[model samples]
Target: MFKGSFVALVTPMLASGEIDKDSLQNLVEWHIESGSHGLVAVGTTGESATLPMDEHIEVVKLIVDYAQGRIPVIAGNGANATDEAIFLSQEMAKFAIDGFLSVVPYYNKPQQRGMIAHFEAIASATDLPLLLYNVPSRTVADLKTESVAQLAKHANIVGLKDATGDLNRLAETKAVVDNNFALFSGDDGSGCDYLCQGGHGVISVTANIVPQTMSEMCDAALANDFALAKKLDEKLVGLHKELFVEPNPVMPKWALYKMGKIKDPCLRLPMVLPELNSQKLIEQRLSQLGLIHP
Candidate 1:
């Protein structure tokens, strides 16, 4: 059910780090109007690591309510603790959220067997389809190919978001997994190639600014129109790289604030605004892409 440009949405917050409820709702509306395929709320780009559980659920609930089934809402239901992950998924499933993007258990660095067990337990916890988020750069514990194939067997374990940026593995992954299992790219830099190589879509950070473009690009790639897809993807190459120049959401949130899309670019402790140099580069790139006026 999850395909196309699902934006890893930025959680709008005030200068005091309070969740900007009105701004958050407005952001959701903007994405839907801009033709984003779906929304992935409170993911790493949304600063999930620092947000308290209560606030995390509140953010998901806000997106779910605001979406009102207009678009799919994939709640970021990942945790290092398997039990916590299961509990959060079960609770969030109570809402109208369409699915869950459960990242690999981070820091703990579980073995492949342990990874299988962790995800299986989560899949059994709720009927909601689970998309395994494997961003090893942040998680440290990579979900190896074998483990992913094993997890794909579970009826509720629907798909995977591979952020490794290794397209070679896609062929091998497709070979073992069921045909129905979706494989999405979590890396925006290689998203077009990933789609060309048979990825269903991307859970994108860049889409926070260029939702319509990203959606169009994914649609073109999925439709086998590589010429148009490449054309669209070329324009987004700068955003895919610079958005991560200062850690996620740091630059993404700032870009939004600069575009006047949000009230404040304020981020939680341990993540501040980008440096002036980084800001200038981002602003120049945005202007070149016509995301904002010069």
Candidate 2:
């Protein structure tokens, strides 16, 4: 049921590397005002890997409580371990998040059957809707087309956020699954085509920076207006690529800082701020888009 320009929101943090509640509140307001379809709080862009369990749940709770049904909030519940993911989902469910975005198990690189087992276990544990996240680049283990179809059988396993960017899989997955299964494009560059190819929506990193344009593009695509969707997506091409020029949330956070949406783009340990060259490229793109002063 979740669709359209759901931002992989960055967790706003202080220069001291602490969660900034005021800035986070302001960001929720800005996104709602800017017309983001929904919010994916504590996803990859939200630095989920770096956050402690308490902090992660706190962030999700804060957003859910603040949003107050203004928009849907999908809590990031992916973990390397199946039990950890299930426990996290169970804990967060108490807060009443709209759904959970569970990524493929990273580092371990399980086989398709193992992947199926992992998701099925999580599905059995919670009645909440679960969106499978398959980013082979980050997770190593690719959740194959057949594997996704297998997971789709479970009642709670609702949809997928596919970063594979293979449009063929859009048609492939749809061919196998029931009509109710939603397919959200996680690859921003291919999002317009994904929709035109019959995908449901996008779970976008670019939307964190340009929520209105992304939301409008998804609206156009969903309306079957490829002309309008392509035109809107064209403007975002620079953002789609540049935001990932460094590891996520680095450049995205920087872009938000430049837009004055957040105070400091401070990241946690192991993910420092972007370098000078990367910063210059990001700034040039932001200026080109008129998101920042030239």
Candidate 3:
């Protein structure tokens, strides 16, 4: 059901730190037109952690409704607390969401047994298809392949978003996981390699800014057109280096706001505005790509 390029959407906000609804809807439509296969709301790219519950669920509902089945809406239902994840999971499931992108429990590192229990409880609670998100850089506790393959036994646990960046682990997961189970790259930089190693797609942050190019790269990788994929990857070469010069969405939001595609691009506390240097880098690249006005 969920396959191909899914953009990890940026949550557009006003200067006063409120989400801009019209801008958000427009962004969703833009992704659909640019050939993104689906959309992920309120993930790391959206700064999901900083959003209040009402705003979070509201964003999920808005994206689900906006997508209107043209593409799947995968809600980011991740929390360090299993209870918090459960609450958000149930809330999002109330909408017409096609799937839940559950990050490996962040902050409070859980053991393998705890990880299994957490996902099992979520599966028991809702019918939304589950996409296990393993971005160890943010979540700290990596969801290992042994455990992920074991969890894939559940009918609802459908796929994985691997950010581990270790090609060997991806190979292991592909080797052990069920033939029907799917794998998608979570790291934008090495996404082509992951696809070559049997990854079906990517949950991409880069796609938010350059969906056409990202979609082409994923299509090439899926079709085993390594030559074309490499060609497309060159267009995105700086994206991997610059987007993280500060942190995600900070740079991405700047890119979009510079393009006047978004309004204020306010980021929440603890994760403040980007450094002037980082923002300048973003501006320079956006200009170079012709994505921003001078």
Candidate 4:
């Protein structure tokens, strides 16, 4: 049931590095108003790595509350440890979240069989629909198409967010899974192309800045109006590329702050602010889009 521009939301923080509840709630309302289809909280873009378990759970809970059944909320419940992934899934299931975005086990790369086992265990732990996330660039562990097809058999394991940015692989993946199984592009740069190629939706990072454009682009593509979708997507190509000029959420947070959407562009330790050159590049893109003044 989940589809369209599901923003991999960035958790707004105060200058003290604490979660900014007001900013978070405001963002939720803004997305809903902007026509974003769903919210994916505490994912990589949300800086889940820096957030402690308690804070992670808290953010998901808050997003659910703020959404108030108006939009779907998918909790980022992935962990490198199988047990930890299960624990997160179970804990997040207590909230009103629509599903879980569980990443491929990172750091300690697992075999295909191990990955299947890892997701199977998580599926058994909760009835919530689970979306497997394959981001080998960061995880170093690719979730193979065969393994994904295998996991797609589990009722609880309902879909996947493929970040490889390979449209050919998307066709291959679509070939393997049943039509009912959802396939989302985790890569923003190719999101419209992904939809045109038959992806159900996008779990987008760029949507954090231009939720309206992303949502509209997805709508056009889903409606089979590829010309309109391409036109809309062209406006976003700069954001899709530049937001990652530094690591994710750093530039996104800064863009938000510049837009007066948040008070501070605070990030936790080990993930600091973007360099001045990167900031200028991001600002230039934002300005080009008319999202900010030059």
Candidate 2 lDDT: 0.91
> How close to the true structure is residue 189 of candidate 3, measured as C-alpha lDDT?
86
- lDDT (tens digit, per residue) of candidate 3 on 193-274: 8887778899998898999888988899889898898888887889777988887878888888878889876888877788
| Candidate 4 clashes between residue pairs 3 or more apart in a chain or in different chains | none
Mark the regions of model 4 whose C-alpha exceeds 4 Å error after superposition.
Answer: none
Q: TM-score for each prediction?
A: 0.98, 0.98, 0.97, 0.99
User: What CA RMSD would candidate 1 show?
Assistant: 0.8
Count backbone clashes in candidate 3: 0
Best by lDDT: 4
Candidate 2 lDDT for residue 245: 92
Which sections of candidate 3 miss by over 4 Å? Answer: none
For candidate 2, write residues 142-217 as lDDT tens digits.
9998998889989999999999988898999999998889899999999999998888899998988889999999
lDDT of 2 at 58: 95
**2 versus 3: better TM-score goes to:** 2
lDDT of 4 by residue, 130-199 (tens): 9999999999999999999999999998899999999888999989999989999999999899999999
Stretches of candidate 1 above 4 Å error?
Answer: none
